[model samples]
Target chain A: MIFRSLLAALALMFVMSTATADQRWQRVEAVTQALDNRVPELEGLSLELPLVAEDGSSVSLSVSFTGSLEDGEHIEKIRLFAPGNPRPEVADITLGPLASPANIATRIRLSETQQVVALAITNQDRAFLTTRDVRVTVSGCLVGGGDASAMAMANPRLALAGSARPGQPVTVRSLINHPMETGLRPDGQADDSIEQQLVESLTATLNDEPVLTARFFTGTSANPYLQFQLTPEEEGELKLAWQDQKGEQMEASQAIKF
Target chain B: MGNLFSDHLSAVLWAGALLGVVYGMIAQWSRFCLLRGLFNRWQQNDSRRLRAFALAMAVALVSSQWLAWQAGINLTRTPYHPGNLPVVALIVGGLLFGYGMALANACGARSLVLLGTGNLRSLLVLLVLGIAAYMTMSGVLAEFRLWMEDLYRPTLPATDLTLVTAPLGLDTETGRLVLAGLLSLALTAWALSSRAFRTSPRDWLGGLLIGLLVAAGWWITGVLGADDFDPVRLASLTFVAPVGDSLQYLMLSTGTSLRFGVTVVAGIVAGSFLVALLTREFVWQSFTSPGHNGRAIVGGFLMGVGGIMSIGCTLGQGLSGFSTLAISSFLALAGIVAGSRLALRFSVGSSASH
Candidate 1:
């Protein structure tokens, strides 16, 4: 009886392993192919994510791109993808010349153990890619029955230092409102899956130059908040714009004086 | 100052008043006592009161799980489960806390209600517990606690009780809810069947009302306290931190937001006072001697230190922990009973010698 039970357990383990392996390999292939097709010139984008996340609902992510965004040679966009998720493509952000050269921080959710890919696209349409393996023990996004219509567009709020000198790194805090539906949650009242609706892009421009840009997905908080540092050359207006998957847009501008 | 009475403020005040009225009516009628569980067992050799407390735990466990099921609330994500077990600390902390509760004749929540009736002994105990809790929370004893936490860690890998049930091939959530419900039902049955317990409406009502209070705490923080800019931690009444938090609020009410625990603590005192006044139970009572006062103070200090280390006191761990049915609570509860019994034994031995 013991031997039979052991054999049955081993067989079950083998089946489970094979099933997971097949799904993961397929996802890996699809992700690689998508990266190859979409952002081919990927390089220099470094993703800093926690090695192990206890809760996947608010996993912190930081992306920093090295090298200057000089005239005609700048970062055009950054896209984040969670290959394991049903909607594998999480977010894509477009950057303008006035946006910061690099550095963005946001939270994302992971369904399970999966690779998070960050792809940076340069002005020349070259895509540079980097991937990190994140193990999400239990998905945190499984709250309140994943209903698509339950998501409400949140108003973004910004807070800046009251006073700061030129060339000093001023902290700019921004929070946006949105439910960031992951599309994998079973609908509360329906048998269908909740359609993904997450803020795809955020751009911060200081004096018509890109100061920072970020890509986000459903794993982000209900209302996502971001904090970043910008050494202002002079007191100027910081223009912020964010767009979600449904093409909803919100913009805010703040004037800073030293 | 303009923002003080704004819509948010009105909502908070109304919420507090509603909570206060409910708590006053229920707590006054029920006579909820966390210390009674251990004391009854030690002094009377009766498990009925303890069983009632356990029944409350069972009810809390089932109801909390039900709420979680309905709201999709995940207890595993909370700070209570840091994914690591500090076993030695929990056991030691539980024992110390139990002993203190016996010494003071009340736990933290009871102290608040007792204070409302002008029990000067409880007032000293509250002060000592609060000060000592703060000391341990961020002051001198914090380093020692952290060092001990690091030294005596258990290898269960994860501290969450739900994780243990997850591997049984049963639906993890369903398994947890069933386990919680069954435990609660068993305790409830045991408590209700006893002729003595059934006859005592005060005790049974107290258990039920306290269970509801624990549930109310979860709703306040999880739902009402939910904010995009600043989200409150999902918590219920746990006495150790809240006592310290209440003291801090008194000094820094301007800087901090109104938390549910603090509001609830305030409400309980006000409710109890009103009840006492109405019932003619509002008497200014103090210890006969400074020696008794000193004992109360020392008891409160031990409870503070122990509660902080254990992550809860009698009410905090007893009711709140029982509500969650988190494995750590079981261990802590056992330790508490053992500690109280030890204290009672020593006292009896000393009296016999005299």
Candidate 2:
């Protein structure tokens, strides 16, 4: 009896696994829309997301690309898409030479249980892809912590981590406060006071050299957080700046040493 | 950006497992269960077990509150404090869970302990309960649960011990101390007042260990697993959702990461089985008749759906949630007690027969 039940469970799992692989990515419009109806190969890209999210409002996600490319070709940018959210345009990250080992991390809002896809576009216009499914239950995507006031966006935070030689880049993380107001407020508590605004763009510089640029959309969680690799060839201050929808900008920096 | 615990989740999971093993052993030794305590207190006119439960609550409260005081952990980040307190879900869910507890003849935590001792009936109860919990939590019945919760969303924005003193012009720090101190003292004094409980070192020792285990739960997930980028969920002992998590983990190991709750559940069973073997309490047991099985099935369904509706079970809301001093915990606790009392008075079959 136990063996029969185990066999039945295994059979059911086989069907589910096949279904997950066959249908999910083929149907997501965001990936095909960016690649112009061509599905990107999942050869050299990886995405990390919790199978079950702690809180769906601000779920932490990381995507990285390490695929070899033809000579004179570099991976220029990577875009994130949460097909489940109201505003699916998650983020667009443009990488520079200083951003070694193209990797990016941030928090995004998921409206429901769905697959999130990452599309990495190279300088040659070739795209590589990876995706992960996150389950968001009833207790998901609720009102996040912190106030929605304009002043709430004041105290931007930046930090550095990871060990590398002076010529090599270390991990750079930055957080700036903003509601990422998607124009659709589920809670409606701060609907009146909070305007529909987000930190549209962010740029980082090390020793006055451009390192990273990212475009944030409404799908980004409140208090937009981001992490990427930045090279510290010479010892100087690392600066991070944020620009909101109204063209308002915020800046924060930290010292870098070998 | 999220590497500290994310990189070493196995270590955190191991800690949870160790704690679960400790809890299971202690529970087996004490036969620590709220249902058993209630049954004995009301049906047999003995309150020794009930007092032990109270003592456990007291220790958990004092220790968990101390952690919060020291900023060793942030209690406010927990799910017990949603924006709109779902008062309706609490009463309905708690009542169903209580009734289910009486019908199934064991609560979620108790059932796990029983399963460790080779009770086949507990296996059935756990499977149904886990499925039902997932049904209400994220499955087919989720829509209905969400609708009911949204229909009646009128309640205090945030209800905790400080709610009492906030209106009385006392600061939050003073209010937490004043309220938690009085309640903890009253509970401890009541437990100690019972000569039966005081005389039984084994009973009080169970209470102490379980309480410390709950606090250690918070420490493992909240403090030791604390990471700004990849923070672990602030949770302690609660069996309703964790059981479902364990079931999901069994099937979807490749897709998902191992969570603390699932590991805790696994640890509890192992720990209980170890103690049961050492004590020679490992005896195979099954339902006597079909009626007994049917009744337990109903009980399991109610517990699964109800536990999710209320967002916790006896251990989840009654002890772990209570330690946070959240007011919603009190309402759920009251509902559960009332439901169990109703079931005890009106249940058709004998509770002890199963």
Candidate 3:
């Protein structure tokens, strides 16, 4: 498995180096390659972020793809990258067959000013990408410690846009309590085992089938909040499952009617 | 979608600016100011303005606590609830702010209102104040400020009145209501005790409207701006950092995100300008002498630096921050009043105070 991963990384590097003259992509190629080996095309994709961020800890991010798809074709995955961070891979989200709108919004961390990139891929092997440059400033006035890490992955809250009609895509927002601890604290935080602990996995499912699956990393902000869209074929329940790197898990569900 | 603000933050800005317009108009008409209240009471033996200010505080405290209960907005998330109290910063910063108020005879919010009424000297004060705030916040003095803040993080179990009443066997919610009710009642009774203050609709109305405005600020930011996608900072009426933020916004509007505070700053100016013109009060005033101009500049700098340290200005700390009943805010207020009194004694003789 280690050898295979190494080969995959090298292949992605070769493809990226020959793909474009834009060195910006090349700089963060390793982090971006967590999605796939193929270079992404900047088409039918939009990534919105503030031009400047006062707090590098958590900056709001929104990415959406509204491209024309072939019959029966659907989006497969979407990934976010912040190369400036200690761990650049922010999150990887997979959309299942039932999902319609590929719009997703979440918060991310940037250690310094850098270009943040978002990539989306369709099941038909088409990849679209976009990037935004964010200038981060030192937050002089930051209060409180952080979210209650003790309750990490405990309660996952979900909000759905009501008045859903058949075949109409509905927006769903999910937020779960977790520190997303980077395990990068300095000496006196009392976190002796300064190892990377994170909410490694999350999934949204309808009828036990996946609607959206996301893999979170240290680059994701605390209390991971993800907003996405889903289209329901009928009245059913959508369940969200979350698990941290420690293998601890939590589940929550919201019923849909119409 | 949560709201239009969920997709875009412009709605939040507009709402904040509208509230600011109301604030500016009311402030202009009523001459509502804490420092003015202090100066007037000290020099002219007029406690009406001070009573109005106290009434505003009482109203803000009661209404804000009420909103938090009904709206389910967590007050703990706000900066007013610092995890580890910076006691030294509060006292020192408050003292400097009070002294600066005496030097300039106005705080940051008052300066903005005066500027709208065509006081060019206010323009100078605002520019310097904004620059000085930035200097202390993120410029040369930022590192020092952070260092001091880090060093002075005194671990306090309770930081606000709600927490103070927790030991009295009441739950958090009940404690909040009990303290807020009692304190607000005390302030209101004292404020209205003076027949002069009771009869003066201008002072009472100013206090009442501004108090309601603070609560409205919480509603806009807490409810309307409560988008999971792009959330606005949970805030109410304040003039300290926002004054500095407005200046920065002017220089980097395109490059930086538009915050609710900056728009409110703009709204206050535009609102005041409109009212001034309509009321035939639009007379441009500038520093009559170099000494006066120098005082304004120094006052601006002191306020900028001091406000940043204390985490608010007269309105920000004395009223808005105080409304939260944060213990540090209480200390800061004490420091400010003392600072202003000392400045009054040293800078101006009893005869000159008037």
Candidate 4:
């Protein structure tokens, strides 16, 4: 009887492995279809993810490129897809002309260990892809609690790394402690569909000249955070303003001296 | 310019290494050992080392609070301040660790320092300890550890000192401040109470320096290392997991990047080696007998398992976790002391053995 059970267990393991492989291929196919069936060049695109993540609520992810784009050609859109998340489509970013170099960093919620894919589209109609395997052991917000809108703009936190100087590059990181409800998920408390509320826009200006601006979607992770670089022409007040989908606008500024 | 995570990650690793080197040097120069403090106090009626440990804790508490106030760090979110308490695991692990340290003659951090000073016995202790810690952390013993966590885990209304006082109508920050202040004051008084301890400048300096370094660690991981997109985990001086991480990093360096904990492990050894060389304390030493090697091996293995189960070692729990005022830290500390006293009673027949 024990020998038979062992044989059964081995068969079960083989079946499970094959099932997982099929799912992975399906996710890749889905991403390829989203990119208009074009097989994206794997070069020049790099996806950065921690090998192991304890908290699935807010895992940091970055998509960067070195030599993917031709001269005068820039990346127009970047989409982050996590096969193991509640929603496969994590975030779709539309970059305007003034968007800081093709590198972008943001946080996303992962449900479990799975393959994460980043696909980028250039203005020249070219598609590129990069993929990473992330292992998430803990679930961050499987059950959504608390009201995301109650304390919408109470505390807006910011971390500035690298010295801020004229002609010197500085990285600005900002996180507004807000539960970005996607309207699709239910708030476990009352079984009510949480309204789709998210930070719709972020704009940064140096001495009143626009340096960076971004638009986010419902798929953007909670406590929306963004990190970008700026090399100032002259030291002045760096203003960061965020306007949520609710049309609630919050602003913070820091004086940068040259 | 490059991947911001990698950029800041390497920055955090380099910073961790520098801080670690400093720690190793100071630890060797001052002869700082947490287990020794307790053993000496009980066995020889000497309280100098104990006073140093107390002074370090007191200083760390005040400075960490100050950093939180300045940097706007919420200590509540740190790993040490988790909402649930694993009662059985902590008590059992802490007891095993205390008894192990007694047999081994040093804690994990001390073993690293001793290893740098050319003590081959410490090398063996650290290897066994690291492997055992990894076993309990993610290896064969992980399932057992998970079962213990699942069985004994109890969610508290709050995990820190604020839980008891929060219901009494005090706000969290206020409650935390009052509690931390009282504890720091009491510790400082005790450290200064003994005339012999008071006159020992080395003890006072060691305590003060180690305390400030612990606070500095919080700032590194919490403030400078804090990035909204990819912030490093908020942690301070801890020896158990880091030793295991150091070993793992050696094997999986390509697949995994260095973290604050792993760098600190490397730093402590590097720093200790440099100091030992400068002070002419770098003598090659090994186990005196087969029996001695067996004792060290057993003690190190127990410490590794205990450290993982409790989630911190003497430095990790006794200082870093204690600084946060986590209730689990206190429970683990009590368990450690009880275990140490038990070992003194049974193993050596008296407290005066070493």
Winner by TM-score = 2
User: In model 3, which runs have C-alpha deviations exceeding 4 angstroms?
Assistant: A1-21, A32-45, A54-57, A66-75, A120-129, A137-144, A147-155, A162-169, A177-199, A231-235, A244-248, A256-258, B1-12, B226-232, B255-258, B345-354
Ranking of all predicted structures according to TM-score, beginning with the best and ending with the worst: 2, 3, 4, 1
Tens digits of lDDT, candidate 3, B57-105: 9999988888888998876667776777777777888898888877887
As for DockQ, the candidate ahead, 2 or 3, is 3
Per-residue lDDT over A179-224 for candidate 3, one digit per residue giving the tens place of the 0 to 100 score: 6777664211334544566888888998787799999987788788
The CA lDDT of each predicted structure is 0.69, 0.81, 0.81, 0.78
Worst 10 residues of 1 chain B by lDDT: B345-354
Model 2 iRMS: 4.8
* Per-candidate interface DockQ score: 0.05, 0.25, 0.26, 0.16
Ranking by lDDT: 2, 3, 4, 1
Off by over 4 Å in 4: A1-60, A64-77, A82-89, A94-103, A107-115, A121-128, A132-154, A157-174, A178-224, A227-258, B1-15, B167-169, B226-231, B346-352
lDDT of 2 by residue, B271-327 (tens): 899999999999999999998898689888889998988878999998898899887
lDDT score at residue B92, model 3, on the 0-100 scale: 86
Provide backbone clash counts, one per model: 17, 0, 0, 0
Error of 3 at B294 (Å): 3.1
Model 1, B1-354: lDDT tens digits are 225445444444456556755665566656676556556655566656676676678767777778877776666545455445677778888898878877777788888887887788888888889888877765677666666555666556335565666677666666777678677778888888788887787788778777777777666566665554555567776778878777877875653445566777788788888888888888999888776676688789888988877878776777776676566777677777777777677642232111
Q: Write out the backbone clash pairs for model 4.
A: none
Which scores higher on DockQ, 2 or 4?
2
Query: In model 1, what lDDT does residue B231 have?
Result: 55
